[model samples]
Target: MAALKTSTTWIKGQEFESEHDGNKINVDGDKKNGHGPKALLLSGLAGCSGIDVVDILHKMKVEFSDFSIDVEADQTEEHPKVFKDIQVTYRLKTATDNLEKVKKAINLSLDKYCGVSAMLKKNSAINYTVEILN
Candidate 1:
């Protein structure tokens, strides 16, 4: 048997919830009005790519003092829907400042890893770039 749970969610005067694992995420339609879903999606992408990059970079023995992922999103002009294009910029600031290695790490994330990226790329153009700042 499969277990299920309901997670509450609301947007744009609509009411709904996410259901899984016998739990619920309720959406009261207060703070999260029109931008909650997109925020969650973007967060997923960042987290997915984040884990991959960190793991790959660690395995590659690339020491970084700081790291950050910047996601810039573009919404459609039409109503009742949005997000036509989203640009993801992966900025990795390391002490060594190896551009090639950093770029390679990012490529690996977008191509091999990062399930969110793979899925989103099918619907939208997600271009990623890496900048190594020392």
Candidate 2:
């Protein structure tokens, strides 16, 4: 089995510093220092899937540009507020003929390759939309 480790250290107030491998980031609950933990989860999901999509598209020889993802979530009002639903929007500029390939790449990433998405989907409903830009 393979394992990955990370650590978070409290800085002050509601802020913390997190490190993984050689990289580090600041996390704050008040949004004063860095991204909140929940928001980071959304970022992880997007980044994970985005990497998969880019790799798959490249392997398929699908030329694209200006690719970006926007993620939004609806949270419950309970004490342990959690995302009930997540919407991921993928925007890219590609030839009209490659639209199908682009969709397939994104689908593969979200459904098969993105571990973050798999985990998040256990608690939140994940929906996606694709916009092919001119």
Candidate 3:
């Protein structure tokens, strides 16, 4: 097993630091309201898909100046404050005629490449929409 190192900050609303080899990550439970560990999952999903898209598009030689995934969640008001559904919006731009390749890349990410989506789908419903901006 590979050893992963992470340091947690002790507070009522705690923030922690996770380091893996040469990479560093900061984790705060509640970014805006001093909450729990939900942001980690949300950010993970976004990062996972974001990485997949960039790599896949780059390999296909799709030229783009910017790419971003914006995410929103619908939460339950009861105990645990769990997410009921998540919507991810993607913005993409390219000069290539191979738009189908881009869609395939995204499909592969959501269906296979993203570990976070795989984990979260067990507990909640995840939905996504893509808008190609010229």
Indicate which candidate wins on TM-score.
2
Off by over 4 Å in 1: 1-6, 9-35
Order of the predicted models by lDDT, top scorer first: 2, 3, 1
Tens-place lDDT per residue, model 3, 48-132, is: 9999988988888777767788878899999978889999887877655656777888888888988888988888888888777
Q: CA lDDT, every prediction?
A: 0.74, 0.94, 0.77
Candidate No. with top lDDT: 2
- Which stretches of model 2 miss by more than 4 angstroms? none
lDDT of 2 at 1: 75
**What TM-score would you give candidate 3 relative to the actual structure?**
0.79
Query: Which digits, one per residue and each the tens of the lDDT, describe model 2 over residues 1-134?
Result: 76988999999999999999989999999999999999999999999999999999999999999999999999999878999999999999999899899889988998899999999989999999999999
Q: What is the C-alpha RMSD of each candidate to the true structure, in Å?
A: 4.0, 1.0, 2.9
Model 3 scores worst on lDDT over the 10 consecutive residues at 27-36
Residues 12-101 of candidate 1 have per-residue lDDT tens digits of 465456656666544433535333567668877988988898998899998885688888788877785666788888776676547788
Judge candidate 1 against the unseen true structure and give its global Cα lDDT, from 0 to 1. Answer: 0.74
Report how far off residue 31 is in candidate 3 (Å): 2.9
The local lDDT score (0 to 100) that residue 58 gets in candidate 3 is 84
How many residue pairs clash (N, CA or C atoms closer than 3 angstroms) in each of the candidate models, in the order given? Answer: 9, 0, 0
